[model samples]
Target: MDSIYHTLRKSNPASARILVRKVLEKNNGNVSKTARILGISRATVRRARDGELNDLSRRPKNIRKKMDCFLEKLIAEEAKSTGYRYRLLSYYLKNKYSIECHPPC
Candidate 1:
């Protein structure tokens, strides 16, 4: 329907695609079946279901790397100021940095 298209157009395309996939799954993957239920064309349903969906949820890898570096620097600075136990520092690094300090495995 025009209203459905308008409503979905207001949303992020990736989210709209995900919603279309859910509808298709609920209808057992039958495009015509889903289209009939959704009141949209089979082609539109298929496009929404099989379109090159963008993952807006993921941060860029470089951003993640920068965050890790920043956290590491913060941990080192805090350790210098607090002079906390090595175990505490190691725990902070492990939990926050996701870096393994002890190689048991």
Candidate 2:
């Protein structure tokens, strides 16, 4: 029991959660009992039981470039020649080349 406490304390959060969940399973999923044994909250025990301890990515799935290669090169040339910043370049591209350039979504 003291060894278990020391092991959990020394391990990373994910590993600790895994250990707790294994113990919870061994105790037949008694939330309060597991929480009490681990000296953690019942909500923490429940969350660990439900496998919600792992980190989730916040990145978007459908990420893509707003502009293509040719348009990118054109913008570079225009920027080199006119020294225009993003907002000005966007306006210039829209009005002059009929390109719908805007900031990334």
The best candidate by lDDT is 2
Each prediction's TM-score against the native?
0.44, 0.55
List of clashing residue pairs for candidate 1 = none
Error of 1 at 6 (Å): 3.8
Candidate 2 minimal-lDDT segment of 10 residues = 1-10
Error of 2 at 86 (Å): 3.0
Q: Which runs in model 1 stand beyond 4 Å of their true positions?
A: 55-105
Model 1 over residues 47-80: C-alpha lDDT tens digits?
A: 8877777644575556532446766587678689
lDDT for 68 (candidate 1): 67
lDDT of each prediction vs. the true structure? Answer: 0.70, 0.78
* Highest-scoring model, TM-score: 2
Deviation from native of the Cα of residue 28 in model 2, angstroms: 3.6
Clashes of 1: 0
